[model samples]
Each structure stands twice: as structure tokens, then as C-alpha cells.
Target chain A: MALLQVTDLKTHFFGRRGVTKAVDGISFDLERGEILGIVGESGSGKSVASLSIMRLVDHPGRVVGGSVHFEGRDLLKLGREEMRTLRGRRMSMVFQEPGTSMNPVLKVGFQIAEAIRSHERVSNQEARERTMDLMELVGIPDAKRRIDQYPHQFSGGMLQRLMIAMGLALSPSLIIADEPVTALDVTIQAQILDLLRDLRDTTDAAVLLITHDMGVVAETCDRVIVMYLGKIVEEAPVAELFDHPKHPYTQGLLGSIPKIDEKQEWLAAIPGTIPNPLEVPTGCRFSNRCPQVMDVCHHVSPELQVVGPGHRVACHLYGETGTVDADA
Target chain B: MPDAVMETRHLVKQFPVEGSRDVVHAVSGVDLIVLRGETLGLVGESGCGKTTMGRLVLRLIEPTAGEVLIEGRDLGALSKRELRRVRSELQIIFQNPFASLNPRMSVEEILRRPMEIHLRISAAERSRRVGLLLEQVGLREEHRNRFPHEFSGGQRQRIAIARALAVEPKFLVLDEPTSALDVSVQAQILNLLKRLQRDLGLTYLFISHDLSAVRHMSDRIAVMYLGKVVETSASETLFNDPQHPYTKALVSAIPVTNPRLRRERVRLTGDIPSPIHLPKGCAFHTRCPFVMDRCRTEGPVLQETGGSASHLVESHLVSCHLVDPA
Candidate 1:
């Protein structure tokens, strides 16, 4: 069995306007020790899906449907107390913007120790020792000296490493890192990504990496799932996704990036902004912006269908020679 | 180039440490010229003095030394009244659109205030100009009444751009204009800036840490390091053949989207050294891949490289050590 399998997950927010379908009927699985990249633009539900898996969605937002199966147990079925026990011990999350995620008042060492003791039945001294070990593992210099400092004392890159250290304190089975390097500089981003890759190689934990940068996914992930308006539009191995992306949205996203070698007059942007979740389009969420959108796409939502080996795309343009009409 | 839009000669700025005798050398001995209707990209890491150079170009902060010339007039020597006159021709678009904008002012008010003060336009003409500027930035007329909080990040940036345009400035200091935006929104903003540049014939001193964005928009790129410019060249030439070790490391660090192609990572292990007390010789020597003994003690001057007459570098003065002395 896969280490984690999310089947038909639907997370929504009960807002004043209506039910905002943040992660509507999305499903993917992470094999043991696999790095699965969830790539999408802002509001594509990539972050929401990861948050839903961890049951960290705040009030007004709830998992309305689907099962998050981890190690043969449905995470959605667990009670609050049971989920809390499994949270820090069995799974940990590294959020985006470490500057905001870390507590300003608490010392970095004590905060990391709190993460350790919350999951494990350990003394304060034991937790501190483990925290230092984690800090060293994440390539922090002078672990003992800087451990007593606050988050603000560290630079943007160092704070990110601290967050990673906290995430690995429990040696969790899974790590859901959501856009961990988004706020960092490119050079620092490359370093932190290398650290994550090295950690994955040495540990048994599966990483559910969520990011909007396709380049990061190409470099780090073994597999990728492309999300669009709360749906997995494409799923394939990282190599396959880059080489042969089937969905129109995925193609547009790839085209939008300014390649290092090529100089174009304009980056090919998708036509429209992401539709508001409160009034999501009925048939295909991306049809409004898709260049190959068709009449059928307007009325019928395409199911995820297998195309090539280990590749799946939720578009009418693939499978049984699925044809898409030219949109004008 | 008597009518060059903006020019700076050996511009130097330092921030004093509160309780100590030390100072933060934010911008040190920088020379730059932006001709009429040109975009000069100032690229560097954080604390590398790119933003400080932008501010100095517009005289937003008082420079400790050096000259700031706009339209062949020395801004540093200008009186308070003369400086106020210069402000009408020079404006800045900040990095964070939300922070720079006044939350209390409506979009129309924000745009109109600049014209009312700088251009001294009548109320009816001010309203008309605000509407035209809004239209120029792809904002609808209805958005004029909305406050900064009522718009998304991208929309707020458009409003910021409109406000910047309201002054009818020939020179614009765009300090990381699209860094806070999404990738698609960034493309939109870039396209908008390009269109505005062509339409208005504006000269831009664009400051950013993002090389990709800089490459897209700039005609010439200047690479800054620890408060000094290390290299200045055409964007394409600099990216293709960077002579400076720091510039080469920066070029190689850009993440490639192609899965098949793997690039060598020039990982700079140590952190960027403190600007409070920069290295005596090369500020980048501590993290440079090819470090020589002379690099620790001898400072290098900017020199024209062998590749192009336009290409200038300050490290070793040459790629080969034998061709040049320390």
C-alpha cells in the first residue's frame, strides 16, 4: 500500500457569500519515501489540500468529503484527540514564510524543543539535545550558540532552516512542506531545496511538496500533480510532466516562465485570473482560461483518465483520442 | 547626452550605527547613467545596495557625497524650491505596493494628489488625468473610488503605477516593482511597464533581486555587490558570459524548468558578509569560487573587458590572472 492515499478530498469554507470549494474532489497518493510535488498557481488548492490532509484547516473551513488514508488508516475518520496525537509525532508540516510561522517571543531552541516534547515523552534536556541535533542536521552553524536566539535574529534563509529543523525534530513519517522557499532569494532557494532533497534521501519520510514554481518541481520531485481551481488536472512523473504535459493549463504555465536561454516578446499568459471559489465554473474549472476549451468542457467535467504510462490528465483533450475544440 | 534623463557620479551613502562609531555603507562610489527612454536594471542580492542606488538616483535620501544630475541639472546643488521642482520630473514606484500606498486615500485621491501638487492642474483636469492614467494602467474607471484595501495585490500594483504616472515624470525609479506579485501578474506588470515606457518615453532605473525579471525588462544590467557595482553590461552578454565570479554564481543559481538539463550549482556556502564592515579588497572574495591571495588585500577598479566595449567588470580586471596584475 502507498504510505498516504487521499481519495476524493473536498475541503470547503462556509463563508457569507456561499460555500467556497477550496479543494474540491482532489485525490493523489504518496509512496513510501517519495517526493510528490503539488504544483499550481495561487488559489489552485495545492496549499489547501495539504492543510486538509493535516486537519489544520481553521474553523469556517472543513473537510466536507473524502478520505485521507495514511498507513492504512483514514485520517478523516480520526477524532480530534487522536488526530492531535498523530499530528506532531507521525506527521509534521513546514509552512511558507518562516518569518511569520515562527513565534517572535520564544527562543528558537525552546520552540524547537516544544515541537520535540509535544510528540515525544522526553525531558526538557533531552528535547534540547534533539533540537540541537536537528539544527546541525539542517546545516545551521554554531547550533548550540544560536539555539538560544529568537527567529528575528536569523536571516531569511536561516529561519527557513530553523523551520525545517523543527519539522524534523520528531522524525515524522511524512512532511507536508507548503511553498517553503517562496519568500527566499534564488540562491538561497537552491540551497534549501538541496537540503530538502538530501534529507529525503537520508530519511524514510515522504514529502508532499507544495509550490507554484515548476522549476522547483522539476528539480526536486519524483512525481507531480498539477492543480487548477481545486482539482488535479494532471498527474505524472516529474520527467513525464515536463516532457509531455497533456493539460492546456499545464502547458500555459510552462510557457509563461521566461526560459534562461530564450527571449520572447511576451510571456504567454493564461487569458483570465483564477475564478473565485464561491462561484466556481460548473464543468471545467480551467475552461474559462484554456486555449483548447470546447463546448463539452463547458457542460461536462472531465474525469481523470490515464493517458501514457503512469500519466493521468483530467481534460477532454486526452484518452481514446480525446479531441478539444479550438477556443476563440 | 546633456539631456540624459538621470545620471549619478560616485554616489555614496552611509547609515550611521546608533550607539557605535561604525556605519552601514549602503551605497559606495557608484556611477550610473540612464539615457532618455532607456531601462537600466540594477540587480543584486539583499543588502547589496541596489535599492539604495535607486533612492540615490531620485535623491529620496540625502547622499553623503557625489552628484545626482537630472536633465543636465545637478540635483544635489539645487535649493529646496529647486528640489521641489525636480520632484515633478522624478518619481519612484516602491517594492511593496500596499505599504507604499496611503490606506486612508482612495485611488482617485492618491493619483489626483500628485497632479494637484506637482502639475498644479485644476480640479476638473485633475479628475480627467486620473481617469486617463487609470485607463492607461488597465484599471477601470470604477476602481477610482476604491481604497487600496479594496483591490488585490496585482490591482493595487496597477494603482501604484497609475499614481506614479500621474506626476508625468520622465525618470522612474522602479524598486522591485513586481517582486511581491505572482508569476502571471509579474508578466502583466512587465508588459505594462514596457508599454508605458514606449508610450511615455520614460527612462527607468529598475532595481530588483530577481535576475529573470531584470533580464526581461532591462536593456543594460548592472550587478551590485556589498554597496558597489561590480559589473555592468548588456543583459544578454552578461547572462551569456559573466566575467565576475559573483555574477557567474548568480547566473548559474537560476533554476531551470527543463527536467533533462542539469546545471552545476555554484552554492555560496557562507552568508553575505555584513555591510557594516565589508571586506577590504573584493566584497565577494569570501564566497567567490576562484579566490586568489591578492583578492584579500587589493581592491579592483572597473575596467572594460575583452568581450565587449560595453562590458565592464571590477574583479581582477580580467578572467586570466596573468593578463592583469592585482
Candidate 2:
């Protein structure tokens, strides 16, 4: 069985203006020990999709439809108490902001120990020792001395390591790290990514990494999923995605990056900014700014169709594999 | 030699620790030269003093010692009125436009208010310039009437750029102007800035942590490490053959988009040292991959690397013992 799978996940927000279909419908699966990356801009619903799978969407936002299966069980179907038992134990999350995610008042070590104790029955001494070990595992030096210090005392990089240690407190099988290294310096960001890679090598921890940086996705992930305004625009192996992106949106994204390997006089920037979630375009979400936009793209939503072995794209330009009837 | 549009000589800024004699060496003894009509990139991690350096050169914050010179005129030596007159030739664009611009002000008012103070033009002239500014920044003239809050992040940044250009400033300090934006929007803004620079003959000191963008935009790049510039070279030389240890790690840390083009990793072990308690000799010695005993006790100074740096703009200065001694 796959480590985690989502089918037709739809998460939307009920605001005063209208329903913002943040994650209208998306589907993907993660294998054991694989790093699956989801890439998109601000309102592409990549973050919301991760939140939906964990069943942790906040008020006014809900998972309207979806089935999230993890370890041979449907997480969405589980009761509140049942889901709570699995959370922080079988699966866990690490978000972008380390300073806000942690409790500012508590001692860094105490907070980590509290998480461990809440999930499992362990004595204070045992939890404390385990917390230090976890801290050291994430490359925090002087873990013994810095254990009692508050969150403010730790640097940004150390604080992020503490968050990762918290996620690994109970030895989760799957980790949903949403922009884990986004709020970090480049050198520190590289170190944290290496730590995650080491974790995968040493254990069976499948990571569903979410980020807006295509460079980070290219370097860290095994497979890539490109999302645009609540839908998957393209999905493929990391190498295939970078080399041969069929979707115009994907191509635009790759070209937008300022690569250090070479120099270009101008970047092929998409024509317009992202449309408001409340006022999405009719047919394809990216049609408004797409360079190769077609006439039919204004009225018919294309389906995700396979174009190569294990590669899929939801673009009219490469829809010969599974043609969608425009009238339907 | 190309004339230095802006120069910082032995610049230093120190902050005192609260209720203590200890001090934070924010920007300590740095020298930089920004050439005319070229983008000079300043890159480093947090607390490397890149932002503080930007402020120091612009005279936004008074330096503890040393001086800033613009076009051979020492800004520190200038009288208050002289400094005010010189301010019209210098401008800045920050990362967040929402913070710099007032929420209640309309685009025309925002563009016109600066002109009223700096140019002292007639109402009709100011209005004409506002429309021209909007059109040049790729925003429609209709957007001049809209409030700042009504525009998107990308469009608001364009307004900020237009506001900077209203005074016809020759030098601009762009501090992480695109860091807060998305990748695609950042590309648009970068391209627009390049176009405007060429059209108006502007000199830019582009400070950012993004190395890729730095490589694409800079004519020369300076690498800072803990309040000091560790390396300065032409953009291509810095990326292709960086000499300083800190620069090598920083350059390698930038995630390349091509998975197959991974460079030899020069891994740094620890986080950036606190500026308040920097290491005794080299600030980066604690995290450097090639730390030696001499590096532990003696600090290095920036010097010309080899024979290739003949031109002033192309000089490659690296502050490392492994390179040529000054």
C-alpha cells in the first residue's frame, strides 16, 4: 500500500464575498520514504492541499470532499479522537514559521518533551533524555546546555531544527513539511534539507514537501506536482519535470527562475498576476496569463492526462493521451 | 577607470548592548565602490550587515565612524542644507511597499507628494510626470487614481519604483526588493528595473540573499560575512571561481534548478555567528569548511586575487589567507 494517498480532495473557504475554491480538486500519492514536492505560487492552494490531507483546515475553510488514506486507513473518516491519536504519532507536520509554531513561554526542551509525553506514556527523565537525543539528531550543538533555554535564545536555524525534532518526536511514518526551509538563510536552508535527506535514508519517513521555490523542489524532491489555482497542472519525476515540461504554465515557471548556471538578458515572465481566488477565470486557471493559450482553454477545464511513463499534465497542448470532450 | 558613483571608506556602525558596555559590531570597517550605471550586488545571510551597509551608504543611519562619498563629495562633511540638497540625487526602494507607502494615499498623491517636495514643479507638470511615471513602470495610467491597498503586491512595487524615479535620482539602494514577491512577479519587477536603469542611466546597489537573481542582475558582486565584505569580483568570476571560503559555501548553497548540474558541495557546519559575540579572528571561522590554525588567530584582509582583475569594475578582491597576500 502507498504511504499516503488523496483522491479528489476539495478544500474551500466560505467568506463573505463567496466561496474561494482553494483546493478545488487534486489527487496524488506518496510512497514510503519518497519525497513528494508540491509547487505553486501564493494562491495556488498547495498549502491548503497539505492542510486538507491532515484534516487541519481552520474555521470558514473545510475539506468538502476527499478521501485521505494513510497506512491502510481513511483519515478523513476517522473520528476526532481517533484522528487525534494518529496525529503527532503516526504522522506529523512541520510548517515554515518556527518561531510562531513553538510556545514562546516554555523551555525549548520542555516543549519538545511535552509533545513526546502527550503521544506516549513516558517518564519525565526518559522524555528529557529522548528530547536531547532528538535535538542532537537534528544537528543542534550543545543540546544539553541549550535544552532549558527559551525559544528566543535560539537562532532561526536552531529553532527550525527544534521544530523538525518535534515532528520526529514520536517517529512518524509520514511527515508533511510545508515550506520547512523557506524562512531560513541559504546556507542554513541547505543544512536543514540535508538533515531531511538523512532522515529519509535512516528511516521510512515519506515527506510531502510544499514550497513556492522551484529550485528547492528540483533539488530535494523525487517527484514534482505543479498546482495552479486549486488544480494540478503537471506531475512528473523531478528529472522529467525539469527537462521536458509540456504545460505552458510549467514552462513559464521554469523560465521565470534566474538560474546561476547561465545568464539571460530577460526572464519570460507570465503576462499577468495571479487572479483573485474569488474571481477565477472560467476554463483554465492559468489561461489568462499563458503564453500559448488556446481558444478552447477559455471555456473547458482540461483533465490531468498521462503524456509519458508516470508523467501527467493537464494542458490542452499535450492532451492527446486522454482527450476531454469540450462540450461535456 | 569608471567613475565611482558612490563610495564607502572604512564605514563602521556599532550598537551597544542594553545595560552593558558590550557592543554589536553590525557593520565594521567596510569599504565599497558602486560604479556609475551598473548594478552592484551585495549578498550574505542574515546579520552579515548587508542591510546595515545599504543604510550606511545612503546615510539613512549615521555611521559610527568613516564616511560616505557621492560623486567625490563627502556626505559626512556636507552641511545640513547641503545634505538635504544631495538627498534629491539618492533614493531607496525597500522590500515591502505597503510599509513604505501610506495606505490612505492614492497613487497620484503618492507620486505627486515626492515631486512637490523635491522638484517644486507646477500642478500640471507634476500631473504629467505622474502619468509618465506610471506608463514607464508598465502600469496603466488609470492605476494612478487607485489607492495603494487596492493594488496587488507586484503593482504596488511598481508604484514604489515610480516614486523613486520621480526625483530623477542617479543612485538607488534596492534592499531585498523582490524577496517578498513570488518568483514570476519577481522576474517582472527585475526586468522592469533593468529597463528603467538603461532608459534613465541609473546606478543601483542591489542587496539580496538570492544568489541566482544576483548573478543575473549584477555587473559586480560583493559577498559579506558578519559585518565585513569577504569577496568582491565581477559577477561571472564570483559565481564561477569564488575564492573566499564563505563565498564558496554561500554560492554552493543556492539550489540550482537543474538536478543534474549539482556542484561540488562546500558544506558549512553551523549557523551564522551572532554579531554581538563574533569569533575572535574570523567571524566565519566557526562555520568554515577549510578552517586552519592561522585562520583561528589572525584575520585576513581583502586583496587583488590574480592577473585577470585589470579593470576597476573587474577587480576580484577576496579576504582569505589561501589567496594572494596584500
Candidate 3:
């Protein structure tokens, strides 16, 4: 069985304006020792889906319908106490900004050790040793002296390393990182990304890396899921997805990026901005901006259908004749 | 007018550390020249002083030392009256459109404010020009009544671009103008900027941490590390054949969009040393993989590299003791 299997997940936010469908009927499976990338723009409900799976959504936002099955149990069906225990043990989440996630006053090592102690009854000394080991493993040099330093003392790259270490405190089987290196500088970002890749090789943990950057997704992720307006528009292996993006949204995203290898006078920019969540379009989310948008695309929403081996795309281009591949 | 639209000679900015004897070495000695109708990309990691360099070019902040000349006229030497007059010649577009523009002000008011100060025109003329500016920036004239809050992030950025173009500035300091937007939206904004530059024949100092975006926009690219211009070359050549170790690491670090083309990463393993307390020689020496014994004591000067130099900016320039002089 897959490590984590999410089926028809629906997370909605109740507001004064209206019910905003953040993660609407999204389903995917993550296997052990795999890094699955969720790529999308802001308000595409990528972050909310991860939050839903973690059961960390607050009062206004609730998982209206979903089954996040992890280790033979439905995560959404678990009680408050049971769900709390599952988190930071079976699975853990790493946020975008490292500075905001950590406390300024507390020592960095102490906080990392605290994560371990929270899950298990370990002695302070034992936790401290493990923290130093994790720090060293994550490539933070001179861990002995740096352990006593506060979060403010650490640079952006160091802090992110600490965050990743905290995520691995309990040897969690699954890790969900949201825009992990977005806030970092390119040099530092490369270090962090390389570390994450290294962690995947060293550990059995399945990582769900959520990011807006296509280059990051291509570099790190083994598999890619393109999301738009709370729906999976495309899903494929990195190579196949990049080379043959069936959906217009995915194609637009690929075309929009200014490639470093070659020089082009003008980019194939998708015309309009992402529509507001409150007033979603009747049919396709990307129809407003799609260059090759058809008349039917403006009214009828296409279902995610398998095109090639392990490749799935949702668009009107492959209409009724599209076959659903059970293996995908 | 000179061939170069804007030129900076030995620009330096050192911010005094609060409650400490130390100073943040924000921008060390640097020289740059932005040619007319060309986009000069200033790329670096955060705290590398690309933004500070842009600000210094516009005289937004007083540089500790150096000269900023626009069309052979020194910004520092200008009197208050002369500065006011010269202000119309240069303009800046900041990163965040939401923060840069006033939330309360209407789109028309925001665009017209610059024209009102710079251009000696009637209110009626300014109003008509506001409509023209709105159209020029891909924003509708009907959006004139809308406040900043009502528009989307992309629309707000369009408004910001419109405001900058209102005064008809020859030189534009675009400091991460598209960084705040999404990729699709960012593409739109970038294209808009390129189109505007072409239409107005405006010179641009495109400062951004985003390498890919900078690669798309700039005619020539300069790689900065810890307030120093470590390397400068023609846009395509720099990426294809990066000479400096710092530049190589930076180029290598950039995630390849194509999975098939993943290159071997040259990792820089060390803490990014504090700018406040720089080392004896290079600021990047601690983290530099190719750090030599000489690099520990003596800094390298920015010199021309052994490349086919057709023009001044296109001539590959790198700062490293190892690189053979042209």
C-alpha cells in the first residue's frame, strides 16, 4: 500500500462573503521515499490541501469531505487527541519562512530537542546529542557552538536547516514542506534544496514539497501535480510533464518561465491574472487566460484523464475518447 | 548626451550598526554603466546591495562615497532646484506594488501625481495624460476611479508602472518589479516593462535576486556578492561561460527547469560571513570553494576577462585572482 493516500479531499473556508472552496475534491497517493511536488500559483489551494492533510486547519476552515489515509488509518476520521499524536510523529510539516516558525529568544538546539521530547520521554542530554547529530547531518558546521545560539543568530539558510531538522525529529514517515526555499537567496536556496534531496536518500520519509517555482519542482521532485483553482489539472513524472504538458495551464506555466539556457526576445505570457476565489469561473479555471482556449472550455469542466503511462491531464483537448488508466 | 545613460563610479554605502562600533558594509567600491535603451541587470543574493545600488543611482539615499551621473550630470553636485528638475529624468519602481502605491489614492491620482510635479501642464492635460498612461501600461482608462485595494496584484503593478512612466523618465530603476507577482503575472509585467522600454527608449537598471527573470530582461548582467560586483558579462555569455568561482556557484545553484540537464553542483560549504565583520580579503572567501592562500590576504580587482569584447558592457569582466587578465 502507498504510505499516504488522499481521496476526494474537500476543504472549505466559511467567511462573511461566501464559502471559498480551498481544496475541492483533490486526490493523490504518495509512496515511501518519494518526493511529490505540488506546483501552483497563490490561491490555487495547494497550501490548504497540505494543511487539510495535516488536520491543522482552524475554526473557519474545515475539511468538509476527505479521507487522508496514512498507515492504515483515515487521518480526517481521527479524534483531536489521536490526530495530535499522529502529527510530529507519523507526519510533520515545514513552513515557508524559517524565521517566523522559530522563536527569537530560545536557543536553536533546545527547540529542536524539545520536538523530540514532546513525542517521547527522552532525557535532556539524549535529545541534545540527537539534535547535534541532526544538525551535523544537515550540514550546519560547528554544531557544538551553534547549538547555543538563538534563531536570530542564525542566517536564513541555517534557520531553514534547523526547520528541516525539527521536521525529522521523530523520524516521521512523511514530511510536507511548503515553499521551503522560496524566501531564501539562490545560493542558500541551492544548499537547502540539496539538503532536502540528501534527506530523501538517507531517510525513508516521503516528502510532499509544495512550491510555486517550476525549476525547483523540476530539480527536486520525482513526480509533479499541477494544481489550478483547487483542482489537479495535470500529473506526471518530471520529464514527461515538462516535455509534454497536456493541459493549457501547465503549458502556459512552462512557457512563461524565462529559461536560463537560451535567450528569447519575448516570453509566451499568459494574458490575465488568476481569478478571485469568491467568484470562480463557471468552467475551467485557466480558460480566461489560456491561449488555445476552446468554446466548450468556457462551460464544461473536463475530468482528469490518463493520456500516457503515469500521465494524467484534465482538458477538453482529449475529450470523451480519453481512457482512465487505473495504474496511474 | 553621453552614450551611457547612467554611470556610477566607486559607489559605496556603509550603514552604521545601531548600538555598536561596527558598520554594515552594504555596498563596497563598485562601478557600473547603463547604456541608453538597454537593461543592465544587477543580480545578487539578499544583502548584496543590488537594491542599495539602485537606490544610490536614483539618489534616494546618500552614498558614503562615489559619483552617480545621469547624462554627464552629477546627482550629488546638483542644487535643490536642479535636483527637482533632474528628478523627472530618473524614476524608480519598487518590489511591492501594494506598499509602493497609496491605498487611499485613486489610480488616476496616483499616476497624475508624478506628472503634476514634473510636468508644467494644466489639470485637464494631466487628466488626459493619465488616461493615456493607463492605456500605455495595459490598464484600462476605466480603472482610473478604482483604488489600489480593489485591483489585483498584477493590476496594482500595472498602476505602479503607469505612475513611473508618467513623468517620461529616461532612466528607470526597476528593483524587483515582478518578484512579488506569480509566474504568469510576472511574465506579463516583465513583457510590459520590455515593451515600455522599447516604446520610450528608456534605460533600465533591473535589480533582482531572481536570476532567470534577470536573464530574460538584461542586455548585460552583473553578479554581486557582499556588495561587490564579482562578475559582469553579456547576458548569454555569462550564463554559458561563467568565470568567477562565485559566479559559477551562483549559476550552478540555479535550479534547472529541465530535469535532463541537471549539472553537477559546486557546493559552497560555510556560513555566509556577516557583512558587518568582513574577512581580511574577500567577503565570499569563507564560503568560496576555490579559495586560495592569496584570496585569504588580498582582494581581486574587477578586470576584463579573455572574451570577445565587441562593446564596453558586453566585455566579460570578473573579479578573482585566478582569472587571467584580458
Candidate 4:
């Protein structure tokens, strides 16, 4: 069985303007030791989906329907107390900005120890030992002295490593990292990615990596999901998605990026911006900007259907055929 | 070859630390020349002085030493009145459009202010020009009355571009203009900038940490490290045949969009050393893959490589110990 399976998840924000369907009817599964990437532009509900899965969405937003099945249990159905216990113990999260995510005043050692103590009924001394071990495991140099330092004392790269250590402290079965290295420099980003890749190899934990960067998805993810205006538009294996993107939105995103290897005089820029969530188009959300958009696309939403082996796309163009070949 | 519209000669800027004699070497000795109608990309990670260098070229921050020349006229030699007149020809587009633009001002007011100051044009003329500028940047005429908060990030950026173009500047220093926008929106802004450049014959010093965007927009690219220019070459050559070790690592680090074409990343271990207390010789020697004994004591100078004739301005130059000075 897959480690985590999400089905028809719906998360919405009830603002004064209207209901913003942030993560409207999304579904996917993550296997053990697999890294699943969720790619999208801003306001596409990728981040909200992760937050919804973790039950971290605040008051304005609520998880309305659907189930997040992890280890044979439906996460959405769990009670608040039970969900709290499961969070740091079985599933943890890493955020984009490590500096802001961590408590400013708390010592690094105490934060890790606290996460351990909260999840497991361990003595303070035992938790301290575990914290030190985690620090060493995440490759913090001089783990002994550094553990006493506050979050402010550490550099951006080191703080992110500390966050990883905290996430790994309880040996969680799953981790949902939302733009974990986006705030970091390219060189530092490489280090964090390497660390994550190494963690995946060593531990049995599955990672749900969320980012806007297609390059990061190509490098790190086993399978990828392309999100648009709160819905999954495309899903495929990493190699298959990049090589053959059937969904017009996915194709446009792939074309928009300036390739470092190939020098093109002009990039195929997708016209227009992401539509306002309050006034999302009745049919396909991307129809307003999609180049290959048809008249039917403007009025009818397409369902996510299997295109090739382990590949699925949601678009009217593929509705007629039901499935497209991997090469096509 | 086109004459350099703007040039910097060994420009340096250092911020003195509060409680110590040490200084933050923000931008060390650097020489750069931006030719007319060409985009020169300056790329580096945070605190590597790409932004400082861009600001230095515009004389936004007074350089601690060295000179900035615009149309062969030294900016430092210009008096206050002359500098104000020169300012119209040189403008900057900041990273965050939301922050750069005033919250109280509407798009129309923001666009018209530059023309009022620089052009000495009538209000009617300014209004007409603002509408035209808005249209040029792909924004609608109705957007002129809306406040900055009302528009999306991409639209706000378009407004920023419109403001920059309002004065009819010949040179612009775009500092991470699209970094704050979404991917699709980023492409839109890039295309708009390219069109505007072609239409107005604008010379740009494009400053960004995003290597891919830089590769797309730039004719020539310069790699900066610890307030120093490590390499400068044509965009194609720099991306394909990066000579400097730091440049090589930077080029390889860009996550290639295609998984099958993943190249072996030259991973540089350790953080960029604090500029306040820099390493002995080469600032990048601590992280350089090809560090040598000579590199530890002697800093390399920018030396021209083989292909000098083809480029419009300087030859393909790199500062590294490995390159033989033949």
C-alpha cells in the first residue's frame, strides 16, 4: 500500500469577498521513500494543499471535504488531539523560510528536544540525548556547542539544516516540505536537496515536496503533480512529464522557463496571469491563458484521466482520446 | 561596436561596521561597461554585491572610490544641477514593485511624476504619455486610476516598468525586476522589457540572482563573488563554456528543466565567508573546487581570453588561477 493517499480533498477560504476554493478536489498518493513534487504558480493552491493535508490551515481556511489516508487511517476524520499526536510523531513539515518557522528565543537543542518530548513519553535527559543525535545526523559541525545556540545565531543554510533535524527527530514516516529551499541561495539549495535525497535513501519516510520551480521538480521528485487554481491539472512520472506534457497548462509552464542549456531568442511566455480565486472561470481554470484552449474548454471542466502508465492529465484536448501515448 | 552608454571604473563601496574598524566590503574594485542597446547581466547570490554594483552604476549610493561615466562624462564631476539632469537618463527598477511604488499614489500619479520632473511637459501631455506608456507595458487604460494594491504582482511590475519608461531614459538598471512575480508573469515582464528595449533602444544593466532569467535577457553576462567580477562573457559562451571555477559551479547548479539532461553538479561546500573578515586572497578560494597554493596568497586579475574580437565591448575575461596568461 502507498504510505499516504489523498482523495478528492477540498479546502476553501471564506473571505468577505467570497469562498476561495484553495485546494478544490485534489487527489494523489505517495509511496514509501518516494519524493512527490507539487508544482504551480502563486495562488495555485499547492501550498494550501500541503497545509490542508497537515491540518495547519488557519481560521479563514478550512478543510471542507475528502480524506487523507495515511497508514490505513483517514487523517481528516481524526480528532483534534489525535491529529496533534500524529503530527510531530508520524508526520512533520518543513517550511520555506526556516528563520521565520522556528521560534526566535528558543535554543536549537530545546526545540528539537521539545518536539521529541511532545511526541514520545520520554524523560528530558533522554530527549536531550536524542536531540544531540539528530543534530549530528543532520551534519551540524560541533554539534555539542551549537545545540545551545539560538536560531538567530545560525546562518540561513545552517538554520534550514536544523529544521531538517527537527523534522527527522521523531523518525516520522512522512514529511511535507513546502518550498523548503526557495529562500536559500543556489549553492545552499543544492546542499539541502542533497540532504533530503540522502534522507530518502536512508529512511523509510516519504516526502511531499511542494515548490514552484520546475527544475527542482525535475531533479528531486519521483512523480510530479502540476496544480492550477486549486486543482490538479497534470500528474506524471518525472521523466514522462517533462518529456511529454499533454495538459496545455503544463506545456505552457514548461515552455515559459528559460533553459540554461539551449539559447532561445524568445521564450514562449504564457499570456495573462492566474485568474482571481474569487472569480475562477466556471469551466477550466487555465482556459483564459491556455494557448491550445478550445471553445469546449471554456464551458466544460476536464477530469483527470490516465494518459500513459502512471501518467494522467486533465484537459479537453485529451477528452476525446482518453489517453495519450508517452511519446505523444 | 556601439559606444558604452554607461561605464564604471574600479568602483568600490564599503560599509563601516558599528563597533569595529572592519568594513563590509559590499562592492570591491570592479570595472564594467554597458554598451548602448545591450543588456549586461550581473548575477550573484545574496550579499555578493550584484545589487550594490547596479546601484553604483546609477550613482544611487555614493561609491567610496572610483568613477561612473555616462556618455564619456564622469558622473562624479557633474554638479547637483547636472546630476539631476543626468538622473532622468538613468533610472532603476527595484526588485519589489509593491515596496518601490508609493502606497498613496495611483498608477496615473506614479507615471506622471517622472515626466513632470524630467520632461517639463504639460499636464495634458503627461496624461496622454502615461496612457500610452500603460498600453505599451500591456496594462489597460482603466488601470491608471487603480492604486498599486489593487493590481496583481505582474500588473504592478508592468506599472513599475511604465514609470521607468515615462521619462524616456536611455539607460536602466533593473534590479531583480521579475524575481517577485510568478513564473508565467515573469515571462510576460521579460517579453515586455525586450519589446520596450527594442522600441526605445534602451541599454540595461540587468541585475539578478536568477541565472536562467539572466541567460535569457542578457547579451553579455558578468558573474560577481564577494564584491568582485569573476567572469564576463557573452551570454552563450558564459552558459556553455564557463571559465572560472565559481562560474562553472553557478552554471551547473541551475536545476536543468529536463531530468535526462542532468549534469554533474560542482557542489561547493561551506557558506560564503563573511565579507567583514574575508579569506586571505581570493574571496572564493575557500569554496573553489580548483583552489591552489598560489590562489591562497595571490588574487587573480581579469584577463582576456582568446575570443576578444567578436564581443562588442570587453573580451571574454575571467579571474582564476587555472587560466594560463598566454
Instruction: Sort all candidates by DockQ, best to worst.
Output: 3, 2, 4, 1
Candidate 1 per-residue C-alpha lDDT over B215-258 given as tens digits, one digit per residue, 9 for 90 to 100: 88887788898888888877787788787878887888787887
Model 3, TM vs. native: 0.97
lDDT of 1: 0.85
Q: Candidate 4: where are CA atoms >4 Å away?
A: A121-126, A320-328, B307-314, B324-326
- Writing each residue's lDDT as its tens digit, candidate 4 over B1-326 gives 45989889999999999999999999999999898899999999998999988888888889999999999999999999999999999989998988988989999999999898899888899999988998999999889899999988998988888999999999999999999989888888888899899988999999999999999999999999999999998898898899999998888888889989766789898789898888887889999888989889988898887755665554789998789563
TM-score, chain B, predicted structure 2: 0.97
lDDT of 3 by residue, A146-202 (tens): 999999988888889999999998999999999999999888888888888889999
lDDT of 4 at A44: 92
lDDT of 4: 0.90
How much lDDT does candidate 3 score?
A: 0.90
TM-score of chain A of 1: 0.94
TM-score of each: 0.91, 0.97, 0.97, 0.96
The alpha-carbon deviation from the true structure for residue B159 of candidate 4, after best TM-score superposition, in angstroms, is 1.0
What DockQ, on C-alphas, does every prediction get?
0.55, 0.83, 0.85, 0.81
Task: Compose the digit string of candidate 3's lDDT tens values, residues B153-249.
Answer: 8999999889989998999999999989999899999999999999889999999989999999999999998899999988988899999998888
Over 4 Å off, model 3: A321-328, B307-310, B324-326
Q: Of the pair 1 and 4, which is ahead by TM-score?
A: 4
**Could you give me the TM-score of model 4 versus the true structure?**
0.96
Best prediction by DockQ: 3
| Candidate 2 runs further than 4 Å off | A320-328, B324-326
The DockQ-derived docking category for candidate 3 is: high
